[model samples]
Target: MVSFKFIHTADLHLDSQFKGISGLSDGIRSFLRESTFTSLDRLVELAVSEQVDFMVISGDVYDAQDSSLQAQLRFYEALDRLGKHGIGVYVIHGNHDPLDSPRMKTGKREHVHVFGPEFEQVTAYRRQDQRAAAVIGGISYPTAKVIENTSLRFQRDKDNSLFHIALLHANIDGDPAHETYSPCTQQDLIASGYDYWALGHIHKRQILHELPHIVYPGNIQGRSIRETGVKGCYVVQVAEDGGVNMRFHDLDTVRWFHETIPIDSIAGEEAFQTQVEERMQEISRECPGKMSIVRFVLTGRGSLHEKLEEGRIAVELLHELHRRAIRSASEPSGLAGLVWVESFDVRSGPWIDREALLKEDSFLGELLRYGQQAREDMTTRAEVLRSALNPLMANRELRMLLNETDDEECAGWLRRAEEMAVLLLAGEGGGESTDED
Candidate 1:
C-alpha cells in the first residue's frame, strides 16, 4: 500500500489580459493584470506548505502568443521556490504556451520536468527515499491547433505497482465555449487505464469521472465575469488501498461574482438605494479579505422599475455604488473589504399583471402572443436569426465580438428586446383595463 500526495492545477494563464473589463479604476486594473502571477505564487506557496510528493500543471501555463518575459521569469521563480523545497514539478504546455513558442532564457530547475510535444513519461519519487511514487504520462501541444485525440496515445505503464496519472489539456466531447484542441472523450480517458486523469483547457472546474478520478482543477484565477466564483486547484491523495481523495483549495486573490437582487417588493427611491447598499454589504461579508468584481442584476416587477429605467437614475446609482466600494477599500483593511460593481443591469418590469395584459384583446396581447411563439419555436427562430445575421458576423471584427458574446449576453439582448416591445405596445391609449392607470 503506497500512499502519496500531489497538487493538480492548470490554466495559470499568466499575464493574460482580462476581457469585457473596461473603465475600471487604475488601482483595480493593475491588480487584475497581476492576478495571474499572484495566483501562481499562491499555488507555489501551497505546494511548498503541503510538501506534496509532486505538482502537475496540466497546461496553459502562460497566455500570450509570444510568452512575456515577465510571466516566464515569474513562473520560473515560483518553480525555483518549489525546487528549493525539494518538491517536483511536472508541466505540459497548452494552446496558449505551445512548444514552438519563444523559450525563456532562464533555464528551469532540476526538479522540474516538462513533457514534450509527443507523449512522454516521467517517474516522480518519494522525496525522502527516492522510491518511484508515481508514473506521470503527458503530451504538450506542439502547436496551438493539434486537434487530434491525444488521450488515445497514452498507454498505461506495464508496472501496475506504481500509480499512473495522465496529464492533458483537451476539450472532452467538444465544449462549445472552448476551442476543440486535443479533443477526446471520457471513454478514451477511462480506457487508458490510468489511475488518475488531470485535465485542463476548460476554465470551469469539473470532475468528469470519479472511479479513476478524471478531473479538471480549472484555471487558478477568474479572468472575467464569465469565470465566476472561487477559482483554484485540487490536492489529490492516493491512499494505500488504491482509493483517491481530492480536495479543492481556493487560490484567487480577487474574485468575480454575479448577483441578482429582486427589487419587486421594495418601494421608494431611498429604500431601493438602501437595498442595493445592503446587497453590496452582504457580498462584502461573503467575500471577506478578497476584492470582488460584482455584476448586479436588478430583476422583478416593482414600482421602482420606471425610476430605474431613467438613464440619470441608473448613472447616479452606479456612481453611488462606486463611491461605496472606494470608501470600503480606503478602510484600514484596504482592498480586502472592497466590492466593486463592474456593472448593474435594470431588468425590472412595471408592476403590471402580465396574465391580465395577455387576456386583453389589444396590441399588448398580440405582442405577448408573438413573444410566446418565438419562445415556443426558439430553435427555428434562432436558426432564422442566425442565418440572417451570418453575413454581418462574417466580418472579422464583427465575428470577434460575436464570439465574445456568450449565452448570457444573447439572453440579455433578447430580454431588452422583449421589454421594448412590451413598453411600446402597452403605451397604446385604447387598450382595455389591464392594470391601474
Candidate 2:
C-alpha cells in the first residue's frame, strides 16, 4: 500500500492583458496588472506549505506567443522555489503557448519536467521515501494548430501498484467560445484507464467525472469580465486503496462578479442608492477577503428609470461606491468590504405596467405595438438600421463593432428602445419624466 499527494492546476495565462476593463483608477489598474503574478506566487506558497510530492500544470503557462520575458522569469523563479524544497513540477503547453511559440523560454531548473509534443511519461517520487509514487503521462502542442485527438495517444502504466495520471490541454468537446484544439471526448479519456485525469484549456472549473476523478482546475486568475468568480486549482490525495480525494483552493488575487438587482420596488434617488449599497454589502459577505470588480445591472420597471437615464446619477453613484469600497478595504472593522463597481447598467423600464399600456388605444399603445413588431422582424429592422448606420460605418472602429449583429443582440436593442419610448411617453403625460432636456 502506498499514498501520495499532488496539486493540479492549469491555464496560468501569465502576463495576459486584462481586456474590456477601462477608465479604472490607477491604483485598481496596477492591482489588476500584477494580480496574475501574485496568484502564481500564492500557488507556490501553498505547494511549499503543504509539501506536496509534485505539482501538475496542464497547459497555457504563458498567455500569448509574445509573452514578456518578465513573466517567464517570474514563472521560473517560482519553480526554483519549489525545486529547493525537493518538489517536482509537470508542465505542458496549450494552444496559447505552444512549443514553437517564439516567446516560450526553456527551463533552466532540474526539478521542472516539461512534456514534449508527443505522449510521454514521467515518474514522481514520494518525499518520505524516494520511491516511485505515481506515473504521469502528457503531451504538448507542437504548434498552435493542433486539432488531433491527443487523448488516444495516452496509455496507462501496466503496474497496478502505482497511481496513474493523465494531463491534457484540449477542448473535451466543441465549445463555441473556445477554439477546438486537441479535441477529445469524455469516452476517450475514460477508456485510458488512468486513476485521475487533469484537464486544461477551459477557464471554468468543472468536474466532468467522479468514478476515476476527471477534473478541470480552471485558470489561476480571471483575465477579463467574462472570466468571473473564484478562479483556482485542486489539491488531490491518492490513498493506498486507490481512493481519490480532491479539494479546491482559490488562488485569484482579484475576483470578477456580475449581479443584477431589481429596482422596481424602490422610489426616490436616495432609496435607489441605499439599495445599491445593500447589494454591495451582500457581495462583500459572499466574497470575503478578496477585492471584487463587479458589474451591476439594474432591472425591472420603475419610476427611478427616468432619473437613472437622465442625470449623472449612475456616474456619481459608481464613484461613491468605489469610495465605499476603498474605505471598506482600509477599515479595521471589516463591516463592509472592498467591492468596486466596474460598470453600472440600467436595464429598468418605465413605471407604467406594460401590459396595461398595450390595451389602451392611445399613441403610447401604438408606439409599443410598433416596437414589438420590429423586435419580431429583426431582419427588416436590421436593414432599416443598416441604412441609417451606413454613413457612420465609414469609421472603421464603429463598423468593426457592428460586424456581427447577432439575433439575440438585435432583440436586446429593440427591447431597450421600446423601454425608452415608453419612458418618453410617460414623461409627456406629466408622469414625472427626468430627462435632462
TM-score of each: 0.92, 0.83
Residue ranges of candidate 2 with Cα displaced over 4 Å: 104-107, 158-161, 285-288, 323-336, 352-396, 399-415, 421-437
Q: Candidate 2: TM-score?
A: 0.83
Instruction: Report the CA-based lDDT of candidate 2 relative to the real structure.
Output: 0.83
Could you give me the TM-score of model 1 versus the true structure?
A: 0.92
Q: What is the C-alpha lDDT of each candidate?
A: 0.83, 0.83
What is candidate 1's lDDT per residue for 1-437, written digit by digit as tens? 47888999999988888876665667777877888888988998898788788899999898756378898889888988888888999999999888888876665478999899889888899776777888899999998789899999998877567889999999998898888999888999989889899999999999999888889999999988889999999998888877999989999988888888787888887887787778878988998878888888889987777777776776887887787666656567678858887877877777667888778777677666666665567674577458656898869998898877765566566666677667655565434654554
Q: What's the residue-level lDDT of 36 in candidate 2?
A: 94
Candidate 2 residues 204-294, lDDT tens each? 9999998778899999999877788899999998898889889899999788888897887988888988887888788878877777778
